[model samples]
Target: MTTWMHPEIGDWEARGRRVAASGPTLGDVDVFVVDAPARTSEELEPLVVVHGFPTSSFDFAHLVDQLSDRRRVVLVDLPGFGLSDKPDAPYRVAGSADAVASVCDQLGLRRFALLSHDMGDTVVGELLARQLDGDWDVDVTRRVVTNGSIYIEMAHLTDGQLMLLSMPDERAARGPGPELLAASLVATLAPAHADVDMSAHAELQCHLGGDRLLPRIIRYIEERRADEARFTGAIEAHPSDLHVVWGPEDPIAVAAMADRLVAARPDATLTWIEGAGHYPQLEEPRSYLEALRAAIG
Candidate 1:
């Protein structure tokens, strides 16, 4: 029902459907969801992926098959991002967490391993909190956390990010076009990964007037700053096994965050993707996949 900026990505879009879900402090709305089934008959805990800021499920278009080879892989475009409804309402991490729960409920997913990138990490943290408090009814078997500002204080916020943060916490009159969004993403990758195609990611981000909602959705960063213990604390305290696969070259989240996670959870495993930055899955797909397989294996 929507016109994609680049029709070539239609196959990826075809794999997903819009589900009725609620957002932070809002009523039921359409949330874009993708559920790639397991290829093998061997039963394995499904993997539910939460994506980062300014991007959508399309981020994993290339890896969904490999990831689902052994178990199901579910991805959702949190409201206000991707092809989801971008209503001019206040956005928060808790609501995004609820959106994930709604999608999982619709799909009959009660337990799964978790993989999160960027802002998705914070959303997972909120879900973890709910599970601990007896709010949401789901089991997070294990976790693989990539680069995100879980430790807000330790983050190196990019210029573009700072600019967006400085804007009013509401829909902007105008927002970055696809080219600008693509450039910002490219800047976060390792130098050697400068050629990664971010076109579809940027286009999907700007869909349904999503460009104007960046300021509203990015408020999750502020939420992390205001309440680190609630988010990062959940990650540290959760009983699920934790494995961290990081791109040491990430300028924003920084390598120290992963080190701190290991320090907090002594038993947690940490794998570094050499020559890769914030988006290791895109920068070094081979190394990232190997590390992911090893983490879940």
Candidate 2:
């Protein structure tokens, strides 16, 4: 097993632990978890953050400190992504939601705010659905939906993404290596963020031979396409106050999706980070955090 050596990755791994999450059909799998406590003595609803596809909990490494300063923040690297174990099994949006629920159960979190991105948004939708169906007991005080195709139809699928979707839904003997994956991720960023070094994130993506699981992990997109109502519908129906924070320059999950989301739910608020793209939290952390904090506040 080859490990990627990067200072940031090392620091992030040190802050989290690998736990055996046994939830519904997902079975027992090792999931990476990070629980950062609040800095102040006050108690606020903990923030549970779910990362997007091809990445892990490390996506929020930049904002964890500030986010935790106000209230506890929890994150997880779901199976087949980040520092977690990558099983050669089919991945489903429901299973991902199960893993998240198991982690929250293990941590004893009854009430928490949700913050999700990309594919994580779908996972959040499932969680919300479970909550609505009375299958999950946790209370979602609020939610923040970042750059993701919550409205999959409105998204502009990149060529690489389209190609991935066309391939067999099984682990490839070989796949786009870390560098190529890194470049692909960087391509989604706004032009102004061209200088960002996404190498470390890509390195983590390749950790534990995860690079080869692209075909399998990317299956989540198919699930999204097949059943938007099951996932996206939960997001729309959940009574929690919705805050849509987006990067206007995102080419995939374009800005119009945000407008459509607010249209569906008139009570939901929309805030755009001007110069950022898909990964707004990474492209403009300060402004993103400001908008996030304001929304959750």
Candidate 3:
């Protein structure tokens, strides 16, 4: 429940734009929400972005300003992540999609575009399926963008990712302390990028100490594995305009997965960003933003 109103975030808030939290009550969980409006009257179509595991809406902090001016950008922290409540239950990809669709319903959003990354891509695929099946009553616009994560051929997981997937009690047994674990989680995102400084490390520590960390990671892993079938099903049912963007340097998801994704959705385009690692949005913001602009437009 800690809200960082730093100068950087404050500047965006000062733009006379609006940001409000809407709790889309989905069963027992309440998904955390943030929405920013378009600057112009004609550019108000809502665009929703979902963050992956270990990260929250905070992941989109760097890109939100740019997108908010042109569209009502919605960033959500799925259950067990960010400022959301972590219920004592199994987390599945379909559950995450249901929560997202609930958020869309609460916001009264119709005909929206989706941008998802890492684990979020899995959730996006599930949500797409629900829409296609007429289970979720939201009109998803044809534009969809997925970056840095594809589950179709993701057969391998990095050591750090594996470690996170290990049971929380097992992770607790490793004894790195909450601070170290959080630092490690952030480190895994970009090993080649500049080292996370002490202050950043402290911030991560606080984030991990929050009640949401362990459950979020656990649910993220569990849901990812459980929803494999649904994910592929969604790909098979994907509309023609879907786009996949990946970082060529990402070790977790190799370029080969892109081939599988493209093969499944022959109409989808795959763009690989050079010199970027797993978190291309953070590692290569300009390039990521350019690619996103093209994909969404």
The C-alpha TM-scores of every prediction are: 0.97, 0.97, 0.81
Off by over 4 Å in 3: 1-26, 143-149, 168-178, 189-192, 196-216
- Reference-based lDDT, each prediction: 0.90, 0.90, 0.63
Model 1 Cα displacement at 143 (Å)?
Answer: 0.5
What digit string (tens of lDDT, one per residue) describes model 1 on residues 1-297?
666768657888899888999644657779988888988753789999999998987877889889998898899998888878899988988888889988998899998999999999999999998899998888889999999999999999999889989999989999898999999999999998899988889999888778889999999999999988989999999999999999999999999999999999999999999999999988899899999999995
Candidate 3 overall Cα lDDT vs. reference? 0.63
Cα deviation at 191, candidate 1, in Å, is 0.7
Worst 10 residues of 3 by lDDT: 15-24
RMSD per prediction, one decimal? 1.3, 1.2, 4.1
Give Cα distance to truth, residue 274, candidate 1, Å: 0.9
Q: Locate the minimum summed-lDDT window of 10 residues in model 2.
A: 1-10
